[model samples]
Target: MNNARTSWLSRSPYWVLSMILHVAILGWLIWYGPVRNIMLERGKPKREALIRGKELEKVIEQMQRSVAEELEDRVTLLKNGQDRMATNFDTLNAHFQPFEENQKATALMRFEKYAAALKADQESLMQVLVQAKATKNFDIASKAGQEKVPVMISALDEVRRGVLLLSSDETIAQMHALAETALFKVEKPLRDIGSLLGRHRRLEREIQESKAQVKLLGSAMQASRDEHERVKKAYDELAAKRKAVLDQMQALRKVKPRNNDAINEANEVFKKLNEQYKTDRKPLSDANRKARDNKYQFDRVNKRLDECVKAFNGLNIQTKLPEYLQLAIDNLAEASALETQVIEQVLAATKDQADESASEVPAS
Candidate 1:
């Protein structure tokens, strides 16, 4: 029976072919996982586009910091200038009382002596200031560079002035001479303040007008900054998109070299991506250029604002002016009081002399 079956199977070609096909299918199923894993090991994965970003310009940030520090410096310097002015005025203020005389010399001699002292003090103070100025490194914020010498050379100037004016019965004549020559010392500056106020009013009007331009520039600068940020974000996105396209091109080059249709398709896609990248760059460049131009205009406006502020601060009338005016008033009041005393003494002396002369006349 076995021999009969074997003969039958050998005679059936279609049955043998069908068995071989079934065996081939089973072998393929068993080896599928290993073949796929081996191929994956041999072939590298396609490139992945990494995410990207950008930051604002460091130069701009640094310039902002520098401007802030410079403003602080200006404030400190202005304060120092005011302080120095107060110090000099205070020194002169203290020395105005003139009762320091030994009372030995004649009135003219004392006057000449006081004048010499005044000359000496003026020369000494000028020399001190000049020497400080000639120094190698002069910092205007410092006392030395500001010519605020600690020496008391000018401390006796007002004292000398008082001595020369109030030394004797010729006090009225001396006062008239001083008024004609020195114009009461503070009167000239007081007179000049009105003219200065006229200038200030005009400058104030200009400053008000300029402020509008400054505000406009400020708005423009802010808009430019916002646009720059938007453009930078979009530019980063575009860079990411271009990188993705580049990765696809690399993968296509590796996998589709033998396929003309796939290669042509990939080339066409790459060309489109490049063209789109260039087209997108136009807006980015425009945004950047606008931001740059706005920054320059902003700087100019800020500089003008600084100039206005400086001009406003330069008003001498604003620097402890009331105190100076009060000082001048006090000096005038003291002189008037001294004049009353002089007139009273002169009248008393004349009356006593008249009574003695009448007695001597004896019945005339």
Candidate 2:
């Protein structure tokens, strides 16, 4: 019995060793594989996803900053432009006051007032833009379901309406005409003097010859001097008129255009005349010269007067006469352009910001 038990033990001994090895391996796996893996997972920071989220966060931050800076710059520009328009309105008002008192009031006076009001409105709109920027909540479309969206939309609508009201065609024409008339007034005297000088030369020459023939030389000499003095006086007066016109033109140029057509025309004319005046010739006719002087003076004055009449006749009623309707149109047009520019810029910046922000949002 002892020998049989020993034989069985010996045979089973290999199986026992194999079982022991298997158990040890299983224990090691539980300690260092499945259990260890669970521990590692619990301790891990989700580094890849966390890194991706952080990068997206930085991108969003950069987009916000870009939008903020752009809005700030736009607000600054609008404020400066509004201030300048306001100043121009004041200057225009002061300029028209004397005309009103003289009972020579043109539609221009009322137009200026309207223009001033329009500029004030623009300033107000700019203030709204500033407020919107400060809020950093310009997402009207996204916030449409919210109460704030309605308020924002309403504000924007009001601004649009105001702009439309200010930029009417009639108002634009009036402003253009006013500016052109002012410029024409400046050129009037110059034209008169030029013609007068030509006539004086002809008259003086004719008188000189007559004096030599009739022995009335002394009287002719005195008359020639008198004529010369008259011409000089007229020249001086015209020069003064030109200076006044130029001052007004400089002021007008600073004003915003209400209509492209009228403003552009006026600008072209103003520039042309201004250049012409710079090269204006002085009266060179000798008043003592015979026959030629008398004829020259007569012809020159007649030609100048004719030219003046023609120029005055050619003036556009819509632009030059200060008609109430025209002035109204111009004001409305200018306001519209200003508002449109502002709104477009604001929308574009906002859209760009939204796009960038969307791109930064992590994919689910």
- Local distance difference test scores for all models: 0.57, 0.50
| Candidate 1: 10-residue stretch with minimal lDDT | 136-145
TM-score of every candidate relative to the true structure? 0.37, 0.18
RMSD of each: 50.2, 41.0
- Give the poorly placed runs of model 1, Cα more than 4 Å off: 1-176, 182-187, 195-211, 303-319, 324-364
**lDDT, candidate 2, 248-358, per-residue tens:** 656666678645665566667667665555544344144435335654555555465555545544543323322322232343345445434544443444456447756
Write down the TM-score for model 1: 0.37
* Per-residue lDDT value at 85 in model 2: 99
Which ranges in model 2 have alpha carbons more than 4 Å from their true place?
A: 1-289, 316-364
User: In each prediction, how many residue pairs overlap at the backbone (N, C-alpha, C within less than 3 A)?
Assistant: 0, 43
